[model samples]
Target: MAEIIEDFLVKKDQGYYCAYGDFYIDPLYPVQQAVVSHAHGDHASPGHQAIYCTEATAAFMQIRYAKQALSSYQVKDFEQKFHLNGVDILFYPAGHILGSAQILMIYQGVRYLYTGDYKLQEDNTCEPIKIVEADVLITETTFADPNVKHPDPKEEILKLAVASNIMLGCYSLGKAQRITALLNQYLPEKEILVHHSMLAFHRIYDKFNEVPMKYELYNRKSMKGDEKNKVYLIPPLTFNSYRRAKNVLRVFASGWARLQASNDLSLYLSDHVDWEDILTFVKQVKPRAIWTLHGDGRQLHAHLSDDLIIRDIFTQTYRPDFC
Candidate 1:
């Protein structure tokens, strides 16, 4: 019998190693030629010698990697097709981050789509997710359990802002921007306080003219414990620490929050597509074979069509030990 998976491949007289969505040189396995779907550390490694990504991903990578050698790598834009050896590849917005992409590879006569984490909901800070049909689909199964269903991002944000004295703690980047924009739309007069990390990303968002609210950025030191009727944006890790703040309610925005693990009343926001959304996307793409990555792949695999041949490959930076 053939190996369930092959690590190395010989194509056009060149040897390459495949690990999930990443590819590298043979013996050296230097991770030289990389097609990154997003700037997330799990997907885009700093160790790669050459990188192909969207312009927005390139910018975020510059901040994350912080080295001229890494910055020297090439960056590509969405929908731009390029040929490496004989394989043709293209990038499409994944709707995960400002520069996130879903890589489409055309090798021989087959088309393979590797979805880096994606969301179907519309976010004001970045391009909307584009649905593309493919022969084989490699997608993230982060919230693939049947019981998981997210409230519309816009509605969740508005509800959180209106119900709480302080809306606090979420991912500093993409999710925060989405929340802030929704807050601006529904609670225009409210004050917003963001963590330093969020402020940095917010600055970048503003640079791109993506910020929806005219708000001030604040740090922990600046917070005077007077957070009444204010929305405080913070990193997920900071949620427990700020739980004691007076008149402050802690809320986390992420796809994972839909699970029972997030039973806390403060956490109700999610920017990712839930189980229902995942099924919808899969049904729409209608791929013959589907590979799951990120989140609970096993749960997702159970729900997919038996004919769709499911394979699990862990590609989440947030949970590196998953594989």
Candidate 2:
């Protein structure tokens, strides 16, 4: 058998390290060279000596971290191949956010694909996912359980039809932009308002969007009058900070059940792939072995056949002959 994934890349205290490439993928803390998958805080950190990612990911990182974003960087387009210490690498769309990408690294003639965070659902706010085959498939099993089936986003967004005024709590980066676009497409009659923190992300998304999202900044005046049919989009921090308001329904847009517990209405919108999507993606990739990360993989492990090895990076130690 070909060399197991451990020889090519393995998880470390800092992040996933590729010894051949001499870089870290989505490191926990800043490192000398970081191959970022996206601009999400957990995936990308500042103060790196050098960085690599797509153009949009870099833009979002700059907007989020400002001057401290990085000391040096290189941006690449989707499917564009480059080399890192002789390790051939390229990016493919992950479809999770504006610049989210699946990093593909080839070393010793074996292909390894690292899915930072990905989704298969149609998201007008960001680029769509592109599938590529690899010998080893490393994936984030965020919603890998068979029972977790995310509802259609269109139907979930339409749940707001009955409410004249809605206060929607969502993440500032990707979620806000997605919900804003959905509201425009599905609930055009309602006036959409956005929180200040998400403006920068929205501006960055607008550059790549064919149809610019329609929204107004959240202001006290916008909430003052009995503004019927108004939807105020606010980040989770602001949403949690707010007090109960009269006649306004509180809703949160997320796939996590915990986040929806306190909401008056539930909107099961998410940017990660569900179990079915994961299986579909796997079939497309046809990897010789599979390694899971980011979430529980027991369900995925039990579901796959013996021909394909499923290793959970967090739960089990890696060995050359493990596969």
lDDT over C-alpha atoms for residue 323 of model 1: 15
Lowest lDDT sum, 10 consecutive residues, model 2, at 314-323
lDDT of each candidate versus the true structure: 0.66, 0.87
Q: Candidate 2 on 1-323: residue-level lDDT in tens?
A: 46764657778777887777788899877688889999999999888888899999999889877876454878899989999899999999999999999999988788999999999999999999999999999999999988899999999999999746888899999999999899899989989888899888888889988999998888888977865889998988788887677678899888899988877989999899999999999999999889899988888988895668888764325433222
Question: Would you list the clashing residue pairs of candidate 1?
Answer: none
RMSD of each: 5.9, 3.4
Question: How close is every model to the real structure, measured as TM-score?
Answer: 0.81, 0.94
Instruction: Give the residue spans of candidate 2 off by over 4 A.
Output: 69-71, 314-323
User: Judged by lDDT against the true structure, how good is candidate 1?
Assistant: 0.66
For candidate 2, the TM-score is 0.94
